[model samples]
Target: MAINARHRLPILLAAALPIGLLLIFESKLTKGADQVAPPTSAPSPPIAPTPTFTPPSGPPTPRTPQFAPREYACSRAAVAPTLDGKLDDAAWASAPWTDDFLDIEGPARTAPRFKTRAKMLWDENNFYIAAELREPHVWATLKSHDEIVFHDNDFEVFIDPNSDTREYYEIEVNAIGTIFDLYLHRRYKEDGPAEHGWDAKGLRTAIHIDGTLNDPSDVDRAWTLEWAIPWSAFSPPVLTQPGFTEAARNAAAPQIGEEWRVNFSRVQWTTTLEGKTTTKPLTAPINDSYTQEPPKETSVTFPYQKVVGKPEDNWVWSPQWQIDMHDPRFWGRVKFVK
Candidate 1:
């Protein structure tokens, strides 16, 4: 055991030197790996995008109202007779009056049949309109000219000379000698008293009753009425044309054939079996004419007649009288027959 010291020293040095070298290399590798790499994290999924929101729409605009213009309907503009000829059986054959008057109410209780006829004629001085209502019983208790004529069985007339569906006129008469003259339109509020200067100038209405009108015992036969409307109440012509104002100075203000708004309505009442007066339609017992609202399916128009020359014309509302029936503008132009 106490052998040579040189042999033991060489073995120990070789083993100890290799072990220290291995430890130093391992420590350096661990420190270098920690400094280079970052912390670990899980991968994320892709996102979907969102859409924008919008609101809904609103309502639509309204439409304009229209009406039937009674232009050519008025006999004043017609070339035939011109509504100024003398009233005789010959001229009466051609007037626009309806023979079979109608009942206003529905077809439940028909009004008694009556003979109704009308005529129109004009002269150098005035335009004339007449109507004759032949009744079975002619009894009139009311005698006032301005009172309600339809309180008893009566006949009514509506005149829209212009026939523009606006600014027309209406009149009512009963067998009892009562007369109700009124202006009409699409509205009632626009109706007012006849104008002072706006006279039907030579207008006249005569009622010839056939029987006792108001007497419950006797029956009325018939009633007649005559009217003469002058051309003075129309609006003055604007100097819109040459010689228009000058021509109107001496000549009639409204030239011949100048039509105004006009229509006729007959409100007739019947004595019911219950001894009560009822509102009857303006139709004949055989035929009903009062239920008509006019032929609206067709277009309406009015033509101006050139009396002396084609004089410049003026209307109550504007270039031409046109408006909504429900509007007040139409009634304001009521010029009454004085």
Candidate 2:
């Protein structure tokens, strides 16, 4: 289902009581600035527009969020681990894992068919994230770096160091180690796109598959990945022309007490075999994300031969209570710990 970026839950306006209690209610009442209230007719002045004020930070989100943001404390790694996908390093012995992911629409809706969990460990040089995703059929085609990796079964990371709802980064990777990294200026409501021009320099990532990839016959267990993002790499400028805030400019590294907005997402798609080569049709289960109904027919691969289905499942560390990942209000908080 496609969520309308412009759609916003309207604020509930308070009902007006009886006119006798109008003044007692303390609601502001106004009169015309240049109007003559007398019986004698006089030329009336033009109406003026009520002024609107915008905050310096960014556009205001809904006063009442669908759910509260979750929080996790990322402990410091006593010994920095290697960038290999293998999470068997001694440094991970004491690192605690986050709770299993729920559907992007919170726990009320359908739960993800497979299990997904993640853990975080940080060093002075890099912010580390490790995830294990349970998938029976592991498949991927994209391999080129910076390509849209999410088109295939992928894992994603979203980070907003300043929590300004602006100037954030999203990184995605598939089982084959294909990666796509982009910088977002604000959110979709403010015309945010995955800015491909911005790059994550010196970012280190690796993936390990427990079973064969792109093989339909075999039953795969799970895929694990580890990402090490250097603090210097995340300092790139963003779009939206607002540039960076004081927090963003100083977000080179997290202090012990600092908190940053973070979230993890996993995309899984169901595939069907039509023939030896031509699988030109894909069928996805009907799942209403928020409000809009899922489209019947979706797009195919770049070659237009292999029909790639829409993501069958979306699992996140912290539920957004909606399908829109661009909304920063529901992102989980990652507190830096010594």
Candidate 3:
């Protein structure tokens, strides 16, 4: 009975050892789980800040100011020719067409033709200009630089001495003449400025007539011209500039009231019936209709008293044509866009 009791005690000891080991392993596992338990309010990983959006810079645009172009009519009296250095009734009758005349400081006065006898004027916002070209036959070709294009019987205006005579502007047209504009440097006569550095902005020219062109034997109609150049392009340098001040180039800083030098020219050619093909030349025959320069009358002055509904206001500079009308360098000035 002692031996049996001793063996039972050994078995009980082995069973107890296994149970003790199992209890220790289970306690260690429970402690590890408690330490690593998912946090009830765990702090989320800091979120990166949202990026900001910004717009890119843009170009500047200036505000457009208000302007009023003093309207005027091109009536017969306003553009009457002064044959003998004065506005004479008899001279007006003798003159084929009573129109504004060019009287400059040049030497072409001996029967100075209408080619160089026109006046140019301007006001603040617009460069105002007018001309009355008298021609027996008026015709023009749309094609540019056509050889003997002047023979097509067109009007031409060449303006250089732009303020300082650096670059120049040239315009050609026929009675039905399509207007052709070109630019050149004062120094070079060829089309240099156009190729290199000269330009024209807002150029417009119109012709008024009493008779129809291309129809020979019909009495000539008085040709009239009207155009406006914007202050924005007064200066070729700052064509794209934001304001008129830059265009003014500090030259009196043309504002609402300013003026600038401008000129007008006409190109008339003599045509003869030499068979079907027209034969025309720059010079005219002795018996051809003669155009003499306006007498050295008076300088055209501006700011003339405004007479509502009267022709007085139409005169930009002075009512009388200036002595040096042909000199585009000294023609007239224009006020800024009001």
Candidate 4:
């Protein structure tokens, strides 16, 4: 969030609504604060794939104000992967991974420095998600669940079933399995600061770090994670279309081709690069619009030598155009499969 934020961090954000709606509701509703974002650079070349994975079916669908969100066809897990962070199960072998993450700001911005991607699956009991992150230094600080886990480099999930954009679910998990989960009544611009009281009940998550934690002395490989969210917990609806009861939604189960609005984010902060420059470039495309001045530099300091308020990078499964991720309308599309 410190670098290329769509909007500033440190304060709650209000997602931008169309001008017509804004004129009518802007002052009528309470807004937390003002926010902003930045300039572009020469784009990076296309991403190369990992030896074990293949590129997404085609060129990424072009993003426009009304472009269709990126889409993935999630297969049903014949045997759910064990929630052990290793991703050693057979189900994962067949599940196609998503394209590498892009600058949350969109194609016009610089691509992320590291490789990050995810895949999905489902069974009658839960919806499953697994992600692989390439990192040279694997580290973490948070441990308590529901605490703001994003302070450290982390992976996040946002889901808005039925796509009403409200009454959605979000979960953040760090390298060591620490978690922060919450439910949003609506976008923060409307009504939010989504309380942490409602947990992802029956949630199962785990992490496997490929390198030493806090020991930046050696080059690390990567980390992988597996998490599951139960259908029953996601059954509750603050509101829904007529005659569509909670029981009915659960009963239908996620059948092949059914779609849901989902997106993923990675928050990375710049740390010391032994003997490298102390002041790091802040234009390195980050998340949420916390990005600052033109070619600005932020001082990296501390136990980790990373700036306290600055993030190294903000990468995501689907680019959000601006640095904001709260606008679920731009989130990638997840379609179910057998």
- Cα lDDT of model 2 overall? 0.64
> Compared with the true structure, what per-residue lDDT tens digits does model 3 show for residues 63-137?
311111111222222232322212223423322322343322222222333332343333344443444555544
In model 4, the runs with Cα more than 4 Å from the true position are 1-66, 235-252, 274-302
- Give the CA lDDT, 0 to 100, for residue 94 in model 2: 78
Better of 1 and 3 by lDDT: 1
lDDT of each: 0.34, 0.64, 0.32, 0.65
Global local distance difference test of model 1:
0.34
Model 3 scores a TM of 0.42
Q: What are the per-residue Cα lDDT tens digits for candidate 1 across 1-338?
A: 00011010101001111110111000010054557555687766665432221211211123312222222223432332322222344544555553343322212223335555555555445455666666554444444555434333455545444535444344555543345554422233233223212223234444443443334454444556555555442332233343222122232533344544433334433333223332222222211111122112121111111111111111111111211122222222223221
Q: After superposition, how far is residue 179 of candidate 2 from its true place, in Å?
A: 1.0
Those runs of model 3 whose alpha carbons end farther than 4 Å from true positions after fitting are 1-109, 113-121, 143-151, 158-162, 189-193, 196-199, 235-259, 273-338
1-338: candidate 4 lDDT, tens digit per residue = 11122322232212222211101000000157775544677788986642221223332355433345788998888998877687778889899999899877665556677899998999888898999889887767665666566666799998877766555778888776777776665665453445456667777876776766655667677888888787866744343545332332452357677888999999876665533332334343324323343222433223455544343566888877655667787789898888
- Candidate with top lDDT is 4
The runs of at least 3 residues in candidate 1 whose Cα sits more than 4 Å from the true structure, single-residue gaps closed, are 1-99, 104-112, 184-186, 189-201, 233-261, 272-338
Per-prediction TM-score, please?
Answer: 0.44, 0.70, 0.42, 0.71
In angstroms, the error of model 2 at 250 is: 3.1
